[model samples]
Target: MTTAERIAAAPTGTETAGHPGPLAYPAARAAGCPFDPAPAVDHARREQPVTRATLWDGSPCWLVTRHQDVRDVLGDPRFSAEATRPGFPFLTAGLRELITSTSSSLIRMDDPEHARLRRMLTADFMVKKVEAMRPDVQRLADDLVDRMTDGRTSADLVTEFALPLPSLVICLLLGVPYEDHDFFQERSRVLLSLRSAPEEVRTSSDELFDYLVRLAESKQHEPDDGIVSRLVARGELDFEEVANMGRLLLIAGHETTANMTALSTLALLRNPAQLAKLREDPSLIKGAVEELLRYLTIVHNGVSRVATEDVTIGGQTIPAGEGVLCTINTANRDDAVFPGGDTLDVSRDARRHVAFGFGVHQCLGQPLARVELQIAVETLLRRLPGLRLDVPFEDVPFRHDMAIYGVHSLPIAW
Candidate 1:
């Protein structure tokens, strides 16, 4: 069956004559599942067209779902990436500070400011620029796999393969000190887990911000040839801004890539024939990755934006100062844009998928990530052709209630 069909075919309650199905669980119950809690949300997005919902923060908000509507909202200046307004997601209070704090980074700003900051970092993530780093990325991927060798096998690929690989590459791009990688990785993971208690999340964010400032200070004199150093060259951003940028990269670059890596592996393992197709024709890897990215929808967390001005989408009026969420997971699965939108079609044309935010604020780390996944997936399949899941399918431990969709540990044995 096609993707949309699969999702449509998946279990949804039937309200038969004189009978009512289960009352819907509140948003906190969203954290109780192993995958994204988007199926219900997507159904609402599609069936009700436009609906009102309570955010995790217990504030009212409008959820946008159809692909065209999502695209329009993303491009609309009214819906800016200011996540601190009323009705922002309550999944993790720490995320408010995490996103809004980057007032200086391109991803967090709008128009001129966002453009200025993005221009500063443009050369580093350009397709040609990242292509040059292809050799280095490949070497890192190969080395990680080489160490994973042993006749008897059980390894947490997230740690041994997926997690470190991106951090190493992103650090290289940003010029972070290698010694501080573990420290940075731990805090990044905790900060991205929205399902955690608020106090713990706040504590981790405080510590991470402090750590980033120190790292930024060290870059002042002994500026290396990296992203921070390049930004330092411009002399436009203040020290705090630089540190915040570092924190942003540390969080966005590593968190999403790691989650998708584990999830993609599961996707491929479940679709062995498609995995073999990718193995035989490495060219298929790129599209396969995009397909997996769209199919997986790793950023299960909704992208919250505040309305700088009044706007209407899908017949609902969002007044000035209201918060709006463009549910990427829901939109990506919308049948309107993606025919068979829910299937994991390795060869599917995912060109229009908005896994990367559209327009000016699209993901800058995309090229680097593409290279990392390209190398990582190709190397893993080539080296461990018989790689299989060690644990029972249902036994896998995953964080269902987090902004990032990922497993606690991706346990596997061949």
Candidate 2:
């Protein structure tokens, strides 16, 4: 078949046969979230849902798609996250090593190691602990709203507020100086921007580590009552481990929350009736948060995993050492799961969605993220009663190529 014919013959909304490889994503024009990933993932799920892909540098990996498949792989102990082992199907040699390193923090660990590190902070992030943060979240939200009405017709909500609120909140939780937060916020933003150079991401990661190293050293001398202080108090976590946790808090705490906040706002604004409904009745804040998380699934490049032993999911076999890519975006929109997958139904029960993920490795900071989002979205509606986009929907900058699916800027006016 001609290359064009091969491309044409490839079915839509399902995975085609054989190993399509990493080139499948089409990075340059890859549409980020708040659009649709289900089509391609659905195609994969229905056909060759579990297939191998050759990395650009020529390593092979499997991409797992179906809902049950993702859960099974993530739930099973055989699918190891220890990329340190040989024959691991890494995206690229450098990234594989970078992602798999023990120094990389909670995201890469598997089983006992993952459980041990995550438990240290899980209690602090529990819903009750996060609920106590409501007042603080409200204050931050109000402050951001207060800043928006000062003669600016439209503001880049992502920067002036969405980004800073979580960054500042996490810093406070870690006892880091608020004044020094811009560096963390900026680097995190840059690191996630799809357009950024690889060196930029590596540098940003290094800068965060450097900052954490200094902060951890200080905590050793004079620890306070934040999460980091607890790690220091136990004297069990090494500087790297503590810094890794700190870095995790800095990156994970803000990046996904920021994207979700902005994307959900954009989604709501596009649907004026919904926006008006939210504005008129702030009681829907909880429902709105779930709907937003479900409909948006802002963290687009769903988590990756590699099988340590052969595993079977949905009647298909994933070889003992192949990578798996879960489509949170696709799974959240599955027609079988969500009756009308494409439509945004705020009133619908979105709890079943996998925005914060599922299984043993679900997000530890989900409660914290919820409070921040609820405050930001609800507060924005109440404060900006006449909020409307200053530019047309198409004019808005959509972040498509990056790992995180979000908007670059949402220009709105009251």
Candidate 3:
């Protein structure tokens, strides 16, 4: 059956003959506390770490909420990441349509294919390679701060600093023109929005794919140092394959870091003591970045996988073909791994977070993300010592509607 048909035919509500109704997956976060995982998620982690939950289509899936269990599910090869597989859970119909309609990237593939594609770009994001770019990232951060602060005491950090910093860096890496950022950024927003319809997702994805394909074709004629150019030079991947990889890198490279930058800044602002502590000790920035990643865990919706064979997780046996959602946000808050997990502590040792995920599919660009965030956050604090919210805390618009959680707009004055 088609995805639409499956969703349409799925049972309504979580009611079952002999069991309690499953809690709704992607439960709403409390109004004032945007940083915490949904209370329902936290409660599930504490009370029922492994339990049934209903997706947007009322499809039942296993929700694994504990830290160890989350790692087990993601680490076990028995759980597949292939979205096209039967019973693979998707957060929204639009996402399902988007993934299945497009050529699969590393994130959407399994096994040798995933590893093969991943190895092609592994050198680009290696810790040493990314660290070498730290100077460049630092320079960019300083330049952006200069631009944002020139004759301006206040600015919307999201537009002026947070978004543009990583967008510029990724554009440089991908060889895409920074001038076309508006074109891609708008489309990316739509692609990431849970509220977007399947048609909207399709249109946006198609435009991006076409754009990347054209860019790759251009690179074939006159190559550059960027990733797309290198891939075109290799001659191993066709234009469409290159485009698929490019699309994934381009969207993921910018969006995730941008959100983390803005959200981390907001988080630090909310925790004055933590901010003060970091300012007093510059060396703490690295650990602080890890702590922020752990505390925020911005991939608010859990990662999805389908069990390929019967496997026990958290004392529950998930049969082959069953869907599983690993709530990393709740896992990050698992008290066993992180004591006092909800509170933000810059000095806390939070290096073991699953924020970047776990096992083979762990974020490939994590090294770059860490450097970008470290520079972005540190530069903001150092350059703008007087930074404070321009609007009241209550007036800040949070991105609850989007699949990724962050502040929609962060107005600040220094």
Query: CA lDDT of 390 in candidate 2?
Result: 83
Error of 1 at 26 (Å): 8.0
Worst 10 residues of 3 by lDDT: 2-11
Q: Could you tell me the lDDT of residue 42 within candidate 2? A: 51
If ranked by TM-score, best first, what sequence of candidates would result? 3, 2, 1
Clashes of each: 3, 8, 0
CA deviation > 4 Å runs, candidate 3: 1-18
1-414, model 3: which lDDT tens digit per residue? 533344344343345653545777767777688899887778778877888888889888999999999999999999999998899999999998788988888898888899999999999999999999999999999999999999989999999989999999999999999999999999999999988999999999999999999999999998999999999999899999999999999999998899999999999999999999999998999999999999998898989999999999988899999999999999999989999999999998999899999989999999999999999999999999998999999999988778778888899999
The residue-by-residue lDDT of candidate 1 on 1-414, one tens digit each, is: 433344444344446643223212123223334443456676666665445555444566667777787788888887877455554444455666555443445566777877877777777788999899889988988888778665457898888888888888887878876678778777766777665555666677778777877777778888888887777667888777777777778778788888788888977887788888888888898898888878777766566677888888877777888766677777788787778775667888887777777666878888877777777887888888788888887787775656778776788876
Tens digit of lDDT per residue, candidate 2, span 185-215? 7877666665566566677778888898889
Clashing residue pairs in candidate 3 (N, C-alpha, C atoms within 3 angstroms) = none
The TM-score of predicted model 3 comes to 0.95
Per-prediction TM-score to the true structure, in the order listed: 0.88, 0.89, 0.95
Q: Choose 1 or 2, whichever is better by lDDT.
A: 2
